[model samples]
Target: MRMALRALPLAFALAPLTAALTPIDALAQPNPAKMTFFITSAGLGNGADLGGLAGADQHCAMLAKAAGAGEHIWHAYLSTSATDGKPAVNARDRIGTGPWYNATGVMIAQSVAHLHDSTANTGKQTSLDEKGGMVNGRGDTPNTHDILTGSTPDGRAYPPGTDTTCNNWTSSGDGSARVGHHDRQGGGEFPTSWNAAHPSRGCSQDNLKASGGAALFYCFGIN
Candidate 1:
C-alpha cells in the first residue's frame, strides 16, 4: 500500500510532462460533443457571398457535424440590414443566450450581454475553430485575422443604406462586408472588437485574402 501511494505521486508528477509532449492535433482537439462555439474550420469558398445566411448556417452545421458537434442548431454570426421586403437581423439575436464554449471546452462568453461587452472571453487563444485549432492571426505568415461579422460593434445590423453585409451576403464582387479580428488586434473603428473590427477591402476572395481574411466566420449553437 505504501509503494502504491508513492507510485501515485510519481505518476501524477509525470502526467503533466507526458501531456506537454502530446501532439497538438492528437490531444488539443477536445470534446466537440459539448462545444457551443467555434469558428468554421472551412468557409464556403465564395468570399463573403456565403450563399446568404441560410447557406452560411448550413455550412456551420455541416462542419459541426463533421466534427461530431451536430446535435445543436448552428447559426452563423452574421447580420442583415433592412431591405425592401426583409427585416433586419442581428447576429447577437440569432445565437442562443450564450454561455458558449469552444471545441476545447473553453467558455467564450457566459451570456449574450457578456459576449457583446468588454468582459467576454474571446481572442486568439479562446476563439478556437471547430476542431479546436487556432486560426491564423496577425503576425502569422499569412494573416487571416479578419473574421466576417457584418454587424456593428454591438452585434447589430447596420442601417438600410450600408452595404456591410456585402449586399446581404449575396454580392461577393462589388460591395464590402464588415469583419472582426478574432485575434482581437489590428486597425479598425473598434480595433479590438471581436465582432466588428472593420470593413473588408471588398467582398471577393482575393480581396478578403489580401485584407487578412479567408472568408471565415463565427458559428454558435442555439440548441
Candidate 2:
C-alpha cells in the first residue's frame, strides 16, 4: 500500500520558464496532527508501484479530506529517469488537473506556477542541431527546489541554508532531493513547521530513482 513515485519528464524540462516567486502569507495555517494522518494514508495507499501523476492526485485528495481544511491543495510528484538517476522532467505538469493552493490555504498566485520537480533541472537545448548539442537528460538535471523555506509553521525561522526537500526525505538520498519540509538539518519538528507554513501546499512526492526506488509522503490538515 505504499505510494509510488511517477516519472514526469515534461514538468522538469519546463520548470524554469514556469517558476515564479510569490509572497509568503502569515495566515491559513496547517494542522500538524492531521497532516501526519494524511501522509500515512498516502504512504499506505500507493507507496510501491510508482503510479505516476494520477497517484499523486489521489493522495492529495485523501490528505485534504483528512485535514478538513479546504478543497484546494497543491500536489507535486517526484520521479527519476531510467537513464539518468535524477528526477524526471516536467513533474509539475499535473498542476493543471487540480486545485493549487499555497501554505496558508490561500489560492496560489497565478504568477506563481508550480514546478513538477523543483529539485530537477530543466532540459535546455543549447545547440542549433538538436542532435549535436548535449541533450539535457537524466543525472545532468539539477535537484528540485526545497519544499519549505527556512521558517516553520509557527513562524520560527531555521538557520540560513536549510536543506528543505521535505527534510531530506527524497526517494533518492544522494543529497539531492528531499521529501517534506526541505530543511534537512532541522529536527523532526520540520513536518509540523511545514504544515503550519503551507497548509494548501501539503502532500509532496519524492521519487528515489536510485536504489530500487523509494517514495516519501507529507500531508497537512484534512478537508
lDDT scores in order: 0.91, 0.30
Measured with C-alpha atoms, the lDDT of residue 141 in candidate 2 is 42
Candidate 1 residue lDDT tens string, 41-146: 7778889999999999999999999999999999999999899898999999999997899998878899999998898999999899998889999999789999
Estimate the TM-score of every prediction: 0.89, 0.31
Superpose all Cα atoms of candidate 2 onto the true structure and report the RMSD in Å to 1 decimal. 23.0
Candidate 2, lDDT over the whole model: 0.30
* TM-score of model 1 (CA atoms): 0.89
Residue 164, candidate 2: Cα error in Å is 19
Give the root-mean-square deviation of each candidate in angstroms.
4.1, 23.0
lDDT of 2 by residue, 132-219 (tens): 1222222334322123221233223233343333332222222233233322222243332222223212222343322111243332
Q: Candidate 2 — which residues are off by over 4 angstroms?
A: 1-42, 45-50, 69-75, 79-89, 97-100, 106-181, 184-214, 217-223
